[model samples]
Target chain A: MVDQVHKEFRRRDLLYSGALWLLSLIIPDPQLHYRREYRFRKRDLFYLLTILLLPLIWSDPHFHHIMVLGGIHGILALGLTLFLGYAGQISLGQAAFFGIGAYTTAVLTTRYGLPSFLAFWASALTAFLFAYLIGRPILKLKGYFLALATLGFGEIFLVMVRESPRLTGGVIGIFDIPFFSFAGFIFDTYLKQYYLIWGVLMGLVLFSKNLIRSKMGRAFLAVAASEDGASAVGIDVSRIKLGVFVIGAAFAGLAGSLFASVMSTANPETFSLNLSVLIVMMVILGGMGNLYGPIAGAIFLTYLIDELSRYQEYSLPIYGVILILLLIFFPDGIGTRLRIRLIYLISYWGRKRRREKVEL
Target chain B: MFLSVEEIVKHYDGVMALNRISLQVRKGTVKGLMGPNGAGKSTLFHLISGMERPDSGKIFFKKRDITGLQTYEISRLGVGRTFQTLQIFGNMTVVENVLTGMHSRIRGGFLSSGLYLPQIKKSEEIAIKEAKEILELLGLFGRWKWFASQLSYGEQRRLEIARGLAAKPDLLLLDEPAAGLTYPEAKQLAQTLSRLKEAGLTLFLIEHHMGMVMEIADEVAVLNNGELLAEGPPDMVKKDPGVIEAYAPRR
Candidate 1:
């Protein structure tokens, strides 16, 4: 086993390129039939390469830490992107699921001595179970009612945590949680953790991208377009809504578990409405329905928060003003404006060439 | 009896929208449902498509009792519907609109699709192939990548039918398909409906355009005052005094 490990651990680019080749191999080639849909394939590949190579250039431990944290938030935001952006549903209870994940890992690892890997999965499962239970009831409500119900559920989770002092550690929170490990390799350093989190994040983004282009993904968009229209096409709108909601919860759980392992703590205060609101804002600011947008939003907002901390007390007000400005300027999404502009430019070029041909 | 609605009654806020309306659409025929404004044409469509429950009635498609089934369930049972107001997914491109309409035909769910399983990839290829074919039939295949919102009104209406066809439903219920079409466009639409009828699909459509309905429908059912006023071959119904009275009303 040691020989096998050493043999495969030769070089980074070789492994990374091998991974990319495998990804390319699995990227089902219906692009010929969907020329327009696959228009951004080259750009996507570029992004993937950049994500893989980004750590080498930015080796600052602090930079890695911030990016690792951003990646975690990015995963959480990606989960909500599928639910809220594609399916056009509202959820304010994402923090509750995140909290569930953290607490699940914290309790299992601390008291029962469960391994981080198993506890991590266990956290996701627990959150999925909870979302399944609550989603059916809450997803029935649409619009602001759904939002309010989710908000209430988040509040209830906080209350439950505070009330269960023995289990949750209540106000003081749980500490000294072990770092994440799998098959004996510990993610103890910020650089290692950075790769780990971003790796997970990129996988999820790929999964989400694959999903949105598939039938079920289209059903989500249809539901967002019009419930009656979705039904007209044989899509079960409510069921799709519930499906995305649970998936989002599971994502939050995964994020939460990672948070616990990295921070080495779990607390009730961390999974509050503010976090939930922040995730929603990330989705909004990044752009809904576009997978990369929310993750970008998460990373940008994380860095923004870090940068603004220099202002001390004035950071929050400035943050609020900046967010409002972003929303106003990029209503569709941060990337949407750029994409639209690119389209306009391309069309303008096409028109100019056509006129030249006509003149000739 | 490929599709049947027996004594379907519906009302809204003390108004008798459809008073015990019973209708049947035979296989491979274009059945036109015509009525004056507020004569319950759309209300009956809502009930048949399972968008709304009838106060009392039974609806059956392919011998399955679908009276109170949810809209998607009824749709899965091979009933596709289009709304009086356009219900196109405007955000999606033309081919995507049709692909979404093929939801019932797709068996892949979140797990299979999100992971892009090999089977899902194969099935999706076939589905997209079929979607393009449907668009080809509507002459919108050339603009398959254009957003639904970018299509002109006539083209959008045809795109709606293209989406309906993508579902490959046995019986399609189109509500007010020709509501806002120009005369030439309506003529083209009538030809398209006639072509669809020849393709062995059942159609029960609601339309206000008398000429198009008369030209394409194998039979016409006229509704007036929440009651069946006339039912016969198009020429016979067109000549019926009761139908003429209800439509013109001596006004």
Candidate 2:
């Protein structure tokens, strides 16, 4: 009976994967179609269509740039999700690490005349080390204390970026950043940049997923649930907290570096305290604890921002109203509610099928 | 002796919590540590489990000094413990909680776990099988998928015990296992502890229930006002004047 059940679960999982694959092929690009249904998963077919159509959408000129921006935001959101959602540590220092990555890439490429790809990774590593050092002391503080400390860190980083004249190019920001490339193929065009960023984002997502399912992920969950309980159960709560913090920051760094290269500049304004808040908002609006929550949140928010930008003066207020509504009605976030609804539907269908089998 | 503590003292904010307490546990024996509320039984458990360091004194497991080891290190040293307040992972399923208990036994690291390596898969399979057997033993087989928070108080307590046992420890420290149990539940727990004892596992438990302690404890140690008051067989400790006086209601 156990074997049969296990086999059935595996079969269902495969079906789910196949359905996802098929669905990825059919959705229209968001840049081409500004419909309300395109903004969120309004229908069962919508998610399927989006997945199926992602590749074709990336091939468009304007959609390609939007995809790059989406990919960068997705990576940043994933990082925040790990720290805020899984590990239960709220940090607003993500923009600081993002700044670090952008600046490192900028300095390496413009000043040092190094390869952009090497600079990108170096920037990420630098951010990871910075996070490891800073996170040790900050992670000891709980909740709002850590949040405030991280906010301070972000502010300090922004100020330094603005003040540093020679290295950071001061408030004017660094320009003439070399484009991302592989084996001498420069990703200068929107299409090339889109594919490059999308590939990296997918890799980050897969890596993050695998990490979430690992022992480290379990330790993070334990720490998140209850520190005292985790300690009692022989988990090194502090170490696990620090590990997730650094890793999350590294993702932010990678996103920042990619953003710098894609935009061909590194500016203090780009990594502001507002960006940190937005990242945190994205994580929460997605669903803090769910893995896919941030992804959905990032994509949704990106499109919302894109659409709202046209309304210029009303954008901020519109965003505020939307967030308030989401929090009030869907406290678990869109991703979690959708998941719950899916499970309910599946179980309902299963029950009906079982009854029909009995009748037959 | 599998574990020993000598002249351990603990203080909290200048107040004595455990004053020069000492104890010994032989291999494969169920020893009882009994005391009134605030008698420092829990503090002693905390000190031994590496939750906190004793102000003065030494702790050893298998003749190796472990005075200042971390909790995870202590756990890795084959000393597993359950919490007084029931620290079972509430969000996880019963089997997942048990698998967490068997974390030390699983050898692969994050990479192996992420990649789902053969070793990790093998270990995971073994862990699931062992967890099932443990649940069956504890009469919780049917509730494997249930969240631990949904279980009855007695079942949760039993699940905590089962989690501790899943570690396959040389010594198990159970803190107030009978604190919230009903009469039948306490009786069942006593039977389970006795079975564990017969299976050659050493146990050090704190209990407020005298009936359960007296029924199952082969040896008993008494603490009063953060100091050891008496130590002997269960009957002898029960009859000790200090033990009775410490627990008795005051006029």
Best by lDDT: 1
TM-score of every model versus the real structure:
0.90, 0.87
- For residues B142-195, write the lDDT of model 1, one tens digit per residue: 999888888998889999999988888999998988878888888888888888
Q: Return the interface RMSD of the candidates, in order shown, one decimal each.
A: 2.4, 6.2
Q: Cα RMSD for candidate 1?
A: 9.1
Give the 10-residue window scoring lowest on summed lDDT in candidate 1 chain A.
A27-36
Worst 10 residues of 2 chain A by lDDT: A30-39
Docking quality of model 1: it rates as: medium
DockQ of each: 0.59, 0.31
Interface DockQ of candidate 2: 0.31
- Which predicted model would earn the best TM-score? 1
Sliding window of 10 residues with minimal summed lDDT for model 2 chain B: B107-116
lDDT of 1 by residue, A1-360 (tens): 556444544443365456545544422222221212332476577677877888889788888889998999999999999999888889999999999999999999999999999999999999999999999888889899999999999999999999999999998889999999999999999988988898888778777777888888888888888999999888988889988999999999999999999999999989999999999999988877677778888999999999999999999999999999988887867766655554455556555654554455
Error of 1 at A188 (Å): 0.9
Backbone N/Cα/C clashes per model = 0, 11
